[model samples]
Target: MIAPADHLTPDALERAQRHLVAKAIAEFAHERLISPERRDDGGWRLTVPLGDAEYLFDAVRAELDHWIVDEDSIRRLVRGTATDLDAQQLILELQPQLGLSDELLPLYLEEIASTLAGSMFKIAQGGPTADALADADADFQTVEAAMTEGHPGFVANNGRIGFGVSDHAAFAPEAGRPFRLVWTAARRSSSHLALGAGIDEEQLLSGELSAAERDRFATRLRDLGEDPADFHLLPVHPWQWENRVAITFAPDLARRDLVLIGESEDEYRAQQSVRTMFNTSHPHRHYVKTALAVQNMGFLRGLSPAYMRVTPAINDWVAELAAGDDTLRDAGFRVLRERASIGYTGDVYHRTAEPSAHRKMLAALWRESPVPLVSGSQRLATLASLLHRDGEGRSVVGALVRASGIPAAEWVRSALRAYLRPVVHCLLAHDLAFMPHGENLILILDEHVPTGVFMKDIGEEVALLSARTLPEDVRRIVSPVDDEEKALAIFTDVFDGVLRHLAGILHVDGVLPEIEFWRLVAETVDEHAAEHPHLDSLVDLRADSFAHSCLNRLQLRNTLRMVDLADQSSSLMYAGRLENPIGRARIPQPAARETVGG
Candidate 1:
């Protein structure tokens, strides 16, 4: 990088001239090879592989003429002082080559004006003698002219350099003592020995000081505000006092204000003992005992009577089975057997076995069935109840039987056949017996039946099956049949019985009147079909038939009101019943009036 100003030698000037010439040649060559063509017909065309074409030749000739004229002007300016030349001519020739445009011209002019203004202001504020001021102003103008001519080489020879001007008077007194100058060998070798100590405003105005001395003089003039620049100046060096600097103490100083409280270790222990005694006397002790029971057993399944009775017993049996010693496992086996017998006998003895008893029995068998003889008997009894119920009961039974260590696939097959095939066949028979292609009954069956018995731990088992799709080493156990089939079978059984069995039971059970029940089924099927229009065919088979079945079930139960149940043909009978109500009211009124008169 070039210094801001250094005396330019003849050789350096010649080198700059040579560089400009070479740049001109390169520009000329580019224009010749890449210039666009203009046709006489007012169209533009680019000739392929432009190798000394006629258009390129004309472009080169034009560029050469401009370059030659500029070169002659530069030569004339270099021979004498470049100050007289038009600044615009030099800018036009050099700015475009330097990648500067007309938009940037104002910024360049502002910078030059600011530079000269700052130098004049600094000299005036420094209180320079008149002669010194004249010389500084003259030097500033000379340097400005050379810069405009693009002869940066000449500007250096004119002794103009940029440097910081410091004001000594502006230094803060409380901050330190004044700094003393020390002449070092390096400063002396650089021919920079003189240093200005104080200002003489009149002397700075005279052209007596050399450029170097004028800079030092300007520094002093700036302090007196006689030749101030556009910006402020700071002292060349500043002294700092240790006492003036702020020191921060440790964080613990703030922490000291916080008062420490609470019990010491010994007191804490004493308080804990008191708390223990109080807690024992509180009603919470019952809750604590119950929580311990649950922890020892397991979490509650549900709060219904069926779940409440079975969950604790099941948990206790599970804990026994999980015990490490044979004694505990045997104890667990005994408990399981007892629970299973009690559950099975409950159905026969009390004849009011909770629906979940079969489920509990199955859960017990699953917990205790590691020993074959004991587990097998439990499995058979549970299976018998489940199958006789047409596998309509709780899922826990099938899960328990499958989970048992019965060592017999036939038993598993029998359980599956009993639960799945019978339900599926019944659904198929009912659906086909009415509407042969109907699949709606299948959907109803799945809703009511236990998913686990049919799908077999569906949440866990399905995921296990999906893993089997991978390579052998990575394969996981899964069901032999696809989940869709399992799901379909489960659903079909439930739906088949929806209109036939479930609606009938609901009527017999008297939970909902038959007409209301049919209305609900109709509304549900219609809304479902409307939402899923694609299932219309399947829905159509069941919609009407199922509604009819619900009506028939309502009739059989005699729960539907005569007005609500009667067909058009039976309307007269229902009308007669309405009249009977009015007649009955009249008979009661006459009796009441006769009693009042007497």
Candidate 2:
């Protein structure tokens, strides 16, 4: 006879059987869907269906297979009234076909029977209740008895379900709500309990818990017979659990807000420094300005005293401009007066001599000056000095007339009248030859007393003839040849070297109009060549052109480099003086000779 219902009561055993049944059904359905077969005619076939139809059929098949005995085995086990054990044995015999062996037969049968009974109970009572079947009570009791035979520590809460642990105090919640019970079952002396929904895992793991709280939670979990490691909880917002845990526990997360609010004073200052450095002409100027501004703003910003010492150098051409050099001054003034006397005010007269009255006026200013006047040679030696000085450094009308270089005294007066009318015209028109500084030697002549006009500079004349107007081969040749060669050499040297140097110092990159600066230098040498054609013939004009071209390129490159250096130094000064004290001190010192030359 089958075992009576009075024999079963364990909940744990019942739950375990039910779990196994669900798993087995899932496995069976999966295998059926994947299994390949052959028909009697030797045609290959797979019974798997597509979509919802496949799932429905597979689930139904799995249920039937779990509950009913196969046709072949029914006769052996059903002699008279079949006992539960006899039924089980018959089920065991079919186990191998189902991929289950003798050792697994008991567990497999129990699981299948539990699932079927539970489903039937749920369906018969209502639609789909979670309540267990009343008919399976005896079966559950039998399974519980059998489970206890293999293990003594087990406790049954109900049916065939069970659990065991060393202690019951380990089920405490670290934070948030207590764990909610999902299911319960029992088998003999053991019980199984599944719980979910509790504290967040992040909150539990965060090291903010105090010593007492940590120990208390640990002890309580042990009492409840659960492993703390096995349970995972959700994380809680930091603000939600304040005093429960220290804020420092999550250093990375905690710093996010603080970092957002923190000021970047150092970075702000650095950017300002960089802006100031680039803004000024010289980097140091920016620094000095910044320092002064900072002090005015009541800050103790540092500034170097050496930066304050770079002033414009005194001009050295002042003495030559004085009337005390009377002969030279008179000659310059005479030339100006002759130009004024002529009707040549604008751009007419190309050649001339210096005048007197203009020279004396300029010379008087230079003689009284404490500092030397700054000027190019064209302005200083020829125009300023010649207008003012005489042979004994005394002014005289006769001497001025003679020095004007005209054969007749009347011509000097005419030139002066011609020259005076053009000063305003030249200044307004930017005429290259009739320039404001008298770099051009234009003379205008009139019928009577000549008005002294633009005074030409003798130094510029010398530079033009000597340095800028020399032939290339003459320039390349070593000094002190024959008189003719000497003259060519001197012209080349002065025109190429001295005049060009002055041009560079004055930043006269494109000032002259009649000739290119270097071409003017070549032309000066050519002028002297008329006296000695042989010396001129010795020069290779083609070679000289190429050489001057190279020199021009070199000079241009050097000028650009100097400009860049000036810009960079200005930037550095603005940023601040050198950090190193000794280096800062040395910044004002003259640059090393090699570096300056390079």
lDDT string, candidate 2, 382-416, tens digits: 11111221212222223333444554324322432
Note the Cα lDDT for every prediction shown: 0.23, 0.22
* TM-score for each predicted model, relative to the true structure: 0.14, 0.15
lDDT of 1 at 96: 39
Give a tens-digit lDDT track for model 1, residues 361-462: 111011112123222122112111221111122222233333443422333333333233333322222211111111111110111121112111111111
539: Cα error in model 1, Å? 9.3
